[model samples]
Target: MTPRTGGRKLCGADELVFYDITASFEERTIFTDILKKTAERVFIPLTVGGGINTLDDFARVLACGADITEDSADKRSLAGIFLSYQAPVEVPGVPLYSYLRTITQKRPELKMTARKFRARVGEIAEQLDMDSSFITRELNVGFSGGEKKKIEMLQLLLLQPKLAILDETDSGLDVDALSVVSRGIEAYRASCDGALLIITHNTRILERLSVDHTHVMVRGRLVAEGPGSLIDDIDAHGFEQFEVAAQAAGA
Candidate 1:
């Protein structure tokens, strides 16, 4: 595939790095069917990553039939999960009653009496068999790291993407949060036939989520790619092995 920047072909197919930075950030959730539709329109291999916090993210990308796996590992996992669900800011000078009336008109199903609201939240919580009070909370804002991860997992349950590239979903999470996130990923894997590319440095998270492939990056290059067991080898021996190989290649 040829990509022209200012009428110049900077690289050919073999040298090209098919990166999809925009798709990752702009499309917070990648839908598999949507991606498949997109893939039908394109011929070249696609590499995509952004805002991917769960297995569903991977499913969407893979459904597109992309070959290379790409991702950004610098994600604010907990904060992002909560902020994604925050209520919209009230317009200046608009009364709360006006806002409520507008929302009720637009979404009649959510128009609830005081008692109805409480009962509905209670019933939905009961149906899920989870804590009711937690369901009524304002949003995921100001939540702990663990709480944030749980929220992300909840979003994943709702999305169910095909091929996911989790860009640092394990970062900043405590042991329990890590376990919860891992279990959520495992659950997703169990329920679907999708692939996962977990980009993380934490082995704790890996303990629960099975890894089929592992790739190492150094100085913006994928220096090594191998099976899931490569993670254990790297943890035990560090990147020294790859570094030596690189030095030899340079020599």
Candidate 2:
């Protein structure tokens, strides 16, 4: 048994453990074997998440004795949740306009015709200072850092999700691109009045936006939390203090 497994054996039945098998999704045989092993050995309540995409997945996990199962991918679309990945995936064969249209039409409440949707997207693209022909190209294929972020922002505006989870949206962006993205985020919050869950190492992106809460996490543990002023503190002092505190507490 692994050292981690040995450690888990010392825990009481009330203790909770989490396992992520997102990478094992493609190899179901291995994934199921792991579930069976974890289920048979662990005595505590288990919350298994990741890589579960369907009803079959849910059934398989529960049948294997996993107490609870959750998958963000399963609920993201139906719940009107948008997540901007740190590195957005590229769709080589799909045109941007076509992809946007497909997702927009899927939401019946939007009640936008194809023509109107096209116009709306164009308007947003223009606002981002993008070329009119930009959306005609394949989605995220052969795009620069700025172009990719612009497309992500376009999706954010077009879909107008109830919650926008932006993961390091400012990564690799130059000053100009960063400025544009900050404006897009500002516009989204102002117009959509949507809840935002932004995860970023850089405080520059948060400058233009209104931050309600700031949380400092180190080594997967939340060490500090406060209001918007926390951002300014972090900007000036950096994360060294929080990291030191986390280390001191054996986080």
* lDDT of every predicted structure (CA atoms): 0.53, 0.78
Question: Total backbone clashes of model 2?
Answer: 0
Assess candidate 1 and give its lDDT.
0.53
Off by over 4 Å in 1: 1-132, 247-251
**Tens digit per residue, CA lDDT, model 1, 1-251:** 55545534466564323334334455544445555654564445565544345544543454457543333322222111212222222234543333333433333324567566456444433433335445434445455656655655554443343445576777887676677777778776876565666767666678765678888876566788878898889889988888888777767
Model 1 Cα shift for residue 27 (angstroms): 30
lDDT of 1 at 102: 45
Compare the candidates by lDDT and give the number of the best one: 2
The digit string of per-residue lDDT tens for model 2 on 1-251 reads: 22236425664456445456656456553276677787777756566656666645655665566655243563445445688977788899999988988888766666597789888998888878888788889999999988899999998988887778999999999999998899889889888957889999899998888899999898788899999999999998999999999898894
Q: What would the TM-score be for candidate 2 when compared with the true structure?
A: 0.72
**Which 10-residue window of candidate 1 scores lowest in summed lDDT?**
74-83
Candidate RMSDs in Å, in order, are 11.2, 9.5
